[model samples]
Target chain A: MSSLIRVRPTKIELIRLKRRRELARKVYRILRERLTILVNEFMTRIRRAYHIRKEINRDILDVYNEAAYLLGLYGGSIYEYYDSTAVENSKVVIGFENIMGVKSYTAMMKKGKFINTYPELNEFRERSIMLISRIIELGRIEQSIKTLGVEINKTKRRVNALEYIFIPRLTSTIKYLQMKFEEREREEKARLKRVKSMLEKHRG
Target chain B: MGVRDAYFEDLVTRVLTRELRIVNRHLPYKRVSLCDLEKMDIPYIVLRDGTAHLIDPRELEYLTNLLGKDKCKLLLPIIIEARQSLGEGTYIVRDRVAKRVIAEILGVEYEEEKPLIIYRPHLYKIREVLPTTTTIIFSPT
Candidate 1:
């Protein structure tokens, strides 16, 4: 009775509470399922982001070494020279990618054309480009993980509320309504019986 | 109950209904073919929410190589239906080609006679390989 929601002790209210309880259960089940999937998605992205970060760390070191070596070999003007030889600047097409209702920015690189420079420099350029692509991928995953985390938290709250609060209250209220109706019926029967006895006594 | 309480009661169900309605808003209104997407400069599909969901060319190329001449049969943004009745952690992919593609990607065996049923781990693996190209829909049934 303490958990019962405040509602009129009528059949209509009982029916409504029952319906609400059913809806809450359905929603709870679905939301719980969704929360599981969202958590799984979060873990998957986290794993991927970790692996990508590892690869980027290793690749970045190698690229850095190459850059230092090239700098020593070709002097400071080498970067300027490389930029001047580029026929087309490197481009990345950034757009949104939605995954299971989670949206995040994704990027695709459009390789740039450049005049053939020193072979070593060309190798460095390719490595750097690959590194940039991996970084972009990392960014995309990181953003998605954040979004999924927020969604998971929100869903968990709703599921918890339905499970522990709303559904229980509705159930108790429904039970209260049923009990009230039964009590009224029993009282009515007893009163009718008392009146019948009184009429028999008067007639006698 | 007071009118205010009744209104509050409806509020709970209303919020749930709204959430369910928006769950699949990211899904495409009509899925496009992989070949058609390849022909476009910036490959993308229009979602039910009226936003463009971009597709990766690399994934398209990989699927193209896998399906070969049947690439056109493969649709953009593969749909994975998640049903509560299927029990927790299980999903179904109904399209024959999508089933084959997912099965091939996940290295799982499936029969053409039945829809492809995959578990959570399989889904994670598939999504890892084809993140942008795959979407999951929550089926109320």
Candidate 2:
């Protein structure tokens, strides 16, 4: 409960504390490295998501305009035609992607079978599928970023605790024990001197 | 020592041991080549932790194009060794083909048949392009 480790000022305790400190330092080094990698991974995903989102935003208007023009030309039947061309519905393969130890759900778009009848519809379908795949990728990156952020925070806390609180506490306790042993040695030397002087005075 | 100190020491040892054991657990049991991975319905490597670490087909294709005929020689899930003795923010890529591929991808030049030493920014760039196909191994020297 106290700031110092409650251990007797013995050589064995000192050895144990030293070993513990070494282990703590090793763990700290490793955790710090992990934190660095995780943060890097997080930043990478953030940048990727930003770029994908930007690309989608820039292209969405054009795609929408194309859709609107098609609607105006062919009316609502255009939607029916596009829908009817599908031999099967589009599929998304969803799975977990583990970046380091942080797991995030990733979805990859699987292109579906289509009749490939109308050129205009085909162009629109291609463009739409591209946009949709980008969106799915963006979603995956965003989720990964979120998960990485949480992991980074957790790792950072452990690193900080080890750096500031735990390692230092162990260090100070070790120092405290060392100093206590030295002081005891000094006191014993002084007492021996006094006792020898007294014995000499009696002999004199 | 008091029981509390003993308990704390035991706990610290346990935690550190666990971390050390699991640090590289995400690594693949056996790395598959790019050519082989491309042949699978779902390209993935079984991790030491018993989980399937998926490899993106896009990444595989990109590497294939980058390496050309040498794609078969290129291993899956490129291992980036982060050694503490290598100093901070520096990683080593020991695989000759992987080094060449990563160097090409990152637009960095490296001597032939030598280990590629990359900095933090380079690592970020590599991970960005090959998020699923690259894994980092932390080595506490």
Candidate 3:
């Protein structure tokens, strides 16, 4: 365990400790502000992510049903020799930006490699591509939310430590040091007065 | 104080300073008046949240005209809000001061006492309008 700061009965140490306490309070305020912003960002992202899932859900069933319909009409053999009408590939660019001082992913997508194929095959492939993009977007949301959550927690913990523990302890320590210094000064003044009286008595 | 306490206090101060620097490092390049956004060379601000939002001078002029310039003490920005009470994909504008400007943009009714709840597409619209000033923030529900 880390030991407590030792008591120093000096005016200088008291001033220094007071300065430290002021810094701690300021840090606490900044951290608390950051925490509020981080949480808001996290919540916003989380909500957006949830809605993305809903969007996917709404689009997916139709696409899947269309796919099944196309397969039934075109026959399973159609799958054997069909041109690629769907998106051949999708390139997802994941960007890292500092949000609330936490580096997290921001997604940008480039549509890639589409070809013309049979009508049914085209429909099926398109649905697949759409689903894939939505899925990728969903993945991006989740990753960002995760990073943000970690950041929010860290900020909160630091705010709590400074506000509840560090500031209070520093305040008390500074107070104690000031009190001790005052007491020592009073004692010295009293001793000096007594010595002066004794010297005067001796001279008389 | 003793050597250990000095060291400990120094450590705390150092850590706090580091955090402060990290947070401040990403602050907007500089806050500019809505009027000057377009005439200025760099018509953009990097939000503290780290989004590079571009401001359009035309829209700023349009808004200033709509809000009657003088009443908009602090120009206007679409503040997208995310609160626990709000549903997913929902953004709200609770600042009544900006509601008039947003109402002009969206053609929605503005209520002095109420907030304007908006959806994703509307969020896009606001972003389109005031990219730099409009920011998303989570509020306590």
lDDT for model 3, on a 0 to 1 scale?
A: 0.66
Full ranking by DockQ: 1, 2, 3
- Model 1, range A1-204, lDDT digits (tens) per residue? 358788877888778778878777878887887788788889989999999999999999999999999999999999999899899998888888776776777777778898988999999999999999899889988988888898888889988988998888888778788989999999999999999999999999
DockQ of 2: 0.68
Residues B55-117, model 1: lDDT tens digits: 888899899999988899988789999998898889999998999899889888999989999
Off by over 4 Å in 3: A1-4, A75-89, A112-130, A196-204, B27-141
True contacts kept of 3: 0.25
Docking quality tier of candidate 2?
Answer: medium
Query: What interface Cα RMSD is found for model 3?
Result: 8.0
Cα displacement (angstroms), candidate 3, residue A181, comes to 2.1
Q: Which stretches of candidate 1 lie over 4 Å from their true place?
A: A195-204
Alpha-carbon error at A70 in model 3, in Å? Answer: 2.0
DockQ scores of the candidates: 0.72, 0.68, 0.16
Whole-model lDDT values for every prediction? 0.87, 0.87, 0.66
Better model by lDDT, 2 or 3? 2
TM-scores of chain A across candidates: 0.89, 0.91, 0.80
